[model samples]
Target: MAATKERALEAAVELLGTDGVRALSHARVDERAGLPAGSTSNWFRTRRALLGGIIDWMAEQERADFSPALLERPTPETIIEGLCTVFLLETGPFAARTRARYALFLELAADDELLAPLSRQRREFERWTDRLVTEAGIPDPVPAARTIMALGDGLVLHRLTVDPELDARPVIERAVRALAASVG
Candidate 1:
């Protein structure tokens, strides 16, 4: 049997996509997981732990496909395609729940409820981002990552919301080429 804590985190992660942070609650999570009442608290002991679990879960899912090979043999096309795939995942089948969790993360940013795990992931994320941006030979990795993240996020959001059948494949390819050109 999956631990109640794991189950709760999964529920919270799923809920984040559509509901945002405010929607998370022990009651709602338990219900979402179809667990018996009180199971969430029974396992996690506190709401803080539960919230931390969700952040950890999200970070895990987000980077599941990343590898160092991409850095060793970097290609603008691959970097762009890899990022686009991750971006699509965030906005599509898994989006609603991530949205809900993100809302909670934003609401509880100052709270220790999500500090440790999220911090760990943030460090790793920055490292990976640095690799990609540096490999691209960009002037600044921070700005490069920020620009890429923003562009990809907007594109995915538009693809998911404004246009049901938006053909972003060509756009993505072109954009990657442009980014590569800026580097060279």
Candidate 2:
């Protein structure tokens, strides 16, 4: 049962990533996952439920990869390098997930039920960013953390579509240094 649900969610991610949100449906998820006709519907009765499941799945996957200890005492250089690495992964290996996440951000902006889970994911990262910036000697960590997050998102989006081969390290390094220097 869990395996079937996992497959359905994976298929749903693929659909949302490749074909956009309009292509997502229980039947399409079943077909994409190669499960029986009722597999997706059995697990997620409504589109909202399926979207919520996907958001949860994404959060689970990300949580497994996150390491809070890494931000214990980070420097600007470490932050820049870390953000650049994440940017590369998002634009390259994790491009599909990135695209799907962006699609959901735009598609479900007005729906609080769906937006809540998504916001939780963002909030987790924001907290991490806050900690990193504060430890790295940024005087105002809150807005700086938000700026860093937005910068990473914008850079990832640009790399994914506008210029696939763009180098993100320099940009990240510049921004991180500027933020770190804003200690007063």
How many times do residue backbones clash in model 2?
0
On residues 1-184, what C-alpha lDDT tens digit does candidate 1 reach at each position? 4676677778877776557676768888899988988888776677777776677677776677455564565567667777766666667677765465456656877877466676676568667866787786655567666667667657776865688666666776776666656742
Q: Could you report the Cα RMSD, in angstroms, for every candidate shown?
A: 3.1, 1.4
lDDT of the candidates, in the order given: 0.69, 0.86
Model 2: lDDT equals 0.86
Index of the highest-TM-score prediction = 2
Pairs of residues at least 3 apart in sequence or in different chains that clash in candidate 2:
none
User: Candidate 2 residues 72-169, lDDT tens each?
Assistant: 67888888877877887778777888899999999999999898988999899898889898888787889888989999989988987899889988
| Candidate 1 residue-wise lDDT at 101 | 43
Cα miss at 32, model 1 (Å)? 1.3
